[model samples]
Target: MKLNKFWATAVMASAAFCGVASAQQGYPKQPIRLVVPYGAGGPTDAVARIVGQAMSTELGTPIIVENKAGGASSIGTNYVVRAQPDGYTLLVVAANLVLNPATGIETPYDALRDLKPIAALANMPILVAVNPKVPAKDLGSLIEWIRAQPESVPYASPGAGTLTQSWGEMLAQKYKLKLTHVPYKGSAEASRAALAGDVPLLFDLGGVTAALIAQGKLQGIVTPGAARAPGLPNLPTARESGFKDVDAESFLGLVGPANLPQDIAAKLNAAANTALKNPRVIESIRSLGLTPTGGTAEAFGSFLSDELKRWTAVAKSTGIRPAQ
Candidate 1:
């Protein structure tokens, strides 16, 4: 009886070990879903499809890019947050994940506590642009023109609590300008508003607005980044435009539900870094006006934390509250 019991224990342990090994080796045996928490054709969706295709090649599995946009991106974000932590369902979201909660909007999931960071995908500067009807030609002139308006000048953003809005608020505060917030459903809508002159000023991802700026419908004022954006080399950065404190950028990254297996996370991170290094992938991302950022899972987590804290402080200073 004692020998039989020992054999049983050994068999169970061996089976468990084999299961783990098999899981690690056969990860993503089926299709992987990459959920984009924004509308299709937007920067986040574009990055998702780009990285998804690259990761599919590396992982030998199909990665389906799904758009689950709405509710300031909380709807799709919560979907991923509540998903299984099996590495199959992942989220590719923009900086709105941090900016949403930082601005006091109640989300269904706690970003830091409920999600495991997989990798930082890319970063894009926010381009400040104005409608052709606006008299501003540069950041300084825009500020002065805004000041001259009898009422608060309206500025359009992708959404109310997005990083674009935060950057708009930062600019307003830095220059002590009276600006009213105009929220749109997505980048397309916001861009339309700016082009139609519904709002004189707009803040959007640099990649999405670069073409419009070139089309002469909108004037590129400044980019809120530490340096000039690669896509808009002629546009000065906020710092260069004399607003050093107005540095803001939108970053996209991958994450899974909390408690994702370490080996799986490592594998995904490695694949992402490899994809970012691909010459084609690099060029594709750069063409979209995004700088590829492939780093360890830990680094992505730290970046998210820092962004949350930074944006939270900005919210407080700007007196931004959750939209009713």
Candidate 2:
């Protein structure tokens, strides 16, 4: 009886190992779902569709994009964070991935601990622009104009606790600029307000304001990046603009639930990098006024760690919080 029991246990272990190997070999055998933690037609959603289609072609499988907009993006993000690690359910998230936690809010999942980075997709540059009516051409002149105001000057952001709002709040707190933040539902509304001069100053994404700058509807000041954004070459960088300690930038990336198989992660990373190199893919992302950025999963993981740390410190120092 003892000998028979030992043989059965050995056979069971062998069968389990074979099962895992077979699953990894035929990974993503079904349609994959790409979850976007926001509403449809937003930048994050747009990116998911663009990259999802390209990656689908590369993998010869259909990639479906589903929007789950709520809890400032936490709802959808947590869903993926708790999903199976089989690579079928993934996340295409934006800065809010880190911003939510950085704002000291309780999140359902830990970004650094619960999600595995797949690839860094693109850079969403933040443009500091003002209505043409504002008497300022650059950030320096804008500062002077803001100081001349009788009360706190009003500025618009996509929403509170966003990278745009952080930059605005940081400047207001650090430089003593009397600025009032006007939080909008999203980028489109905020840009409209800035265009209509409802809010004279605007801190927003480059893609939302790039065309307006071209049309002279808004005055381009500076981009808070290490280098000038490719879409807005003439615009100066915040570092060069003499604003020290402000290296603000936003990006989109892919991630899967924690403990995602290493082989599956590598396959998706390769597909993403190849898709980013395609001419159609590159042009599509550029038309959105974003720079295509693809690199190894390890590199993206490191970038995420740094971003979370930096944004958390910004939230702490500037006291920025999510809009209620």
lDDT of each: 0.86, 0.88
The local lDDT score (0 to 100) that residue 103 gets in candidate 1 is 89
Q: State which candidate has the highest TM-score.
A: 2
Best by lDDT: 2
User: Where's the lowest-lDDT run of ten residues in candidate 1?
Assistant: 207-216
Q: Output the lDDT of residue 314, model 1.
A: 79
Tens digit of lDDT per residue, candidate 1, span 147-203? 888999998887777788887887777778899999887678999999988888889
Note the residue pairs that clash in candidate 2.
none
| Model 1 ranges with Cα > 4 A deviation | 1-18, 133-135, 148-151, 196-198, 322-324
The segments of candidate 2 whose C-alpha lies over 4 angstroms from its true place after superposition are 1-7, 148-150
lDDT of 2 at 100: 84
Query: For model 1, what is the alpha-carbon lDDT of residue 155?
Result: 88
State candidate 2's TM-score: 0.92
